[model samples]
Target chain A: MDVFFQQLVNGLTVGSLYALIALGYTMVYGILKIINFAHGDILMIGTFIGLVLVMNFHLAFVPALLLAMFITALMGILVERLAYRPVRAADKLIALLSALGVSIFLVNFAQLVWGTETHPFPVNISGEPIILGEVHIGTLQIWALGVSLLLMVGLHFFVNHTKMGVAMRATSFNVDYARLMGINVDNIISITFAIGSALAAAAGILIGVYYDAVYPVMGYSAGLKAFTAAVLGGIGSIPGAMLGGLLLGVLENEGAAYLSSGYKDAIAFALLIIILLIKPTGLMGRREQQKV
Target chain B: MLELKNVMVNYGVIPALKSISFKVEEGEIVTLIGANGAGKSTILKAICGLIKLKGGAITYQGDTISGMGAHLIIRRGISQVPEGRGIFANLTVEENLGLGAYVRKDKAEINRNLKVVYDRFPRLFERRKQVGGTLSGGEQQMLAIGRALMAAPKLLLLDEPSMGLAPLVVKEIFKIIKEINQTGTTILLVEQNARMALSVANRGYVMETGQIISHGTARELRDNEDVKKAYLGH
Candidate 1:
């Protein structure tokens, strides 16, 4: 029972990071109707950026995190303008291929600059783990969950109450109709990329803190796991991404702890396959409904 | 209030509007009656800047609005209710109406306009909380019109408002359109239902194959043998 509780706590910490990253995938997918394949690579770049900020610039962890997210957001907008927008009117395959090209380019660019070395994440909360009965919770774990929950809540309010957020929702419904309503559709699309990219950066930094290291290629594995979570929750649904991430984290942690440490990733994949076969639209996803 | 001089629109070298010239005078309901693909809807799209003009110019209130972006054109006081009643199906009726007043800065005037829209279409007010897609077809049309009215447009471009409704519902919608015109907005109506279109229009133009082949007062066009046979179904 103690082992189970510890694993649950560990699972939730990892799950919070996944939820943050998965939001980027789901939001971009929601607006553009294409999986931004470069998203993971972009998160990888964000981790490196945060690391450089702390090491070279000697900035505090909190300010470095904000600066890193802001810079990553600008990078995201640039990527959209240079790579994605030109291929927008083309076939979906063309956009997908372009995204793949961007992912490859970003990975290579990181390798050239960061030199493929895994660096220790130097920042840590100045406290020992909090013990509750038999289970212990790391301060980092608590921070991860608290920040992720706060960001998600902030996102929900922005989407529901703000004028720009309403415009974004309207654009997601119908682009041409949104234009008729005087919405700058291009501007809305750019804002979606900016917000998604910023969230992914925060996730990147959080993951670096949790695992105690950052590397150029870390985005590949983390991004894949987060993408699977988004698909599991229903790719284009915002709340779906959060739910999917949490469930995947818990399941993977439990499977690894009880089943086999070597097959932790394998277990997540197996569950994904089973879920996909049972419900293609995902756990909370409905098929796109268009009324005539 | 609106004038087009030899306006030409092309979709990648295939001409959609061929140097079409027309004038919409202030305070009159003008109907452009044509079959599908005759470019009646295309004209509305062009006027609202949804589609770019390949040649000529569109002027509204003496300022040339040609080459402006679609979003910018709405600020010029022209709003279009597109074909197929382009309602944001996922949003509530109130949200839909709120979006129509998107660019306006005056809060008090926006609230007043909201009241006017709700008063004009009481059914919309009753269903304000419902998602637009769940509404019946007639209700959806009313929502679309109500939304456009929230913009407080000086010129309302209505594209096929009578499409796909029961004749009785179409009559109700047309009566509402006439009432809206009487309350002060100039209308440029495009319709395939020429019988209904002609009944409410002060002046009418008959279009064929992207060209205006005939134009006259509604009574003159209604009595003409060609228009009756081609459009009125007499």
Candidate 2:
């Protein structure tokens, strides 16, 4: 029973990271309807930036995390302007390919600068575990879960109550109508990319702190897992991404604990496939009605 | 006032509108009535800068706005309630209405407009917190018009505002359009429902196969033999 509880805690912590990254995927998809393939590599770049902030600048954990997020957000805006904007009117497939190209370029660029070495992020958080009855939880894990929950709440309010957030939602529903309403769709899209990338960066930083390791390829698995979460919840739904992340994390953790550790990734993929087959619009997504 | 002089538009290789010309005097409700393929919506799109004009000029308030982008055109005091009642499905009714005045920065004026919109459509006021997608077809059309009004536009362009609406609801919508016009916003209405459109408009244009076949006073168009046999179901 204790083992199960411990694994559940671990799953929740990892799930928070997945949820953060998945938010970026879901948000960009919501507004643009194009999958930003480079999103994963953006997470990877975030991790490296966090590493640089800590190792070279000798910054404390929280400050380093903020700097990393800021940098990643700016990088996201640059990517939108340079890569996404030019191909805005192109075919979806072309945009997809362009995102993939940007992803590959970022990965290689990180390799060149960081030298492909697996660098360790300094452990600033105390390694002590707090005992809660029979279950022991790492303090860092608790921090990760708390921050993730806070970020999600912040995002929810931001989208619901704010002026720019309303515009973003409007643009997503119909670009032509949004433009007619005098919403600067280009600026709104750029803001979406910025916010999404910043969330991914936060996830990358938390994951690095928990794992104590960062690499150029760190974004690959994390990205794939978050994408799975986004699909599981509902691609364009904000709350759906959070729910999907936690569910994927718990499912994979329990599967590894009881079934096979080596097949944990396989479990996530299987769940995705099954969900797609059963409900193509996802658990929370509604099927759009077409007008003739 | 708005004028489209020999305006041409094409969709890839096919021509959607061929050298169309018309004028809407300030403070008048002018309508363009036609069948489904008569390029009624295309004219609205061209006016709003959604599609590029191949040739000719669109002059609005003495400025040639033919090549301006949609956002810039809206800033110039024109708003469109497009076909299909294209309200933001995920946003709440209030948020959707708030976005209508996105280009405007005056908070007091915005709030004033909001109160006016709510007073005009008490249904929207009752469902201010509801998501736009869940609204009934009539409510959605009302919300679309209310949103356009939020922009404080000098000119309002409505495309098929009566589509997918019950006749009773259609009557209510036309009533609102007339009220909006009386309050001093010039209107360009495009509709397949010729009778309702002509009833509200001061002048009307008859379009067929992307060309304007006739234009006159709304009463004259309504009484014309060809219009009576084809559109009015006489």
- Could you say which candidate leads in TM-score? 2
Colliding residue pairs in candidate 2: none
Q: Tell me the tens digit of each residue's lDDT in model 2 across B122-224.
A: 9999999999888998999989999999999999999999998999999999999999999999999999999999999999999998899999999999889
lDDT of 2 by residue, A102-168 (tens): 9999999998998898888775775477898888788889889988898899998998788888888
The list of candidate 1 runs beyond 4 A from truth reads: A126-128, A274-278
Q: Which window of 10 residues has the lowest lDDT sum in candidate 1 chain A?
A: A121-130
Can you give the lDDT of residue A152 in candidate 2?
90
Q: Write the per-residue lDDT of candidate 1 for residues A123-156, one digit (tens) a residue.
A: 8466567899999898898878877888889888
The CAPRI class of candidate 2 is medium
Locate the minimum summed-lDDT window of 10 residues in model 1 chain B.
B9-18
Each candidate's interface RMSD (Å, one decimal) is 0.9, 2.0
- In candidate 2, residue A93 scores what lDDT? 91
- TM-score, candidate number 2: 0.97
For residue A8, model 1's alpha carbon misses the true position, in angstroms, by: 2.9
lDDT of 2 at A124: 79
* CA RMSD per model (angstroms): 2.0, 1.6
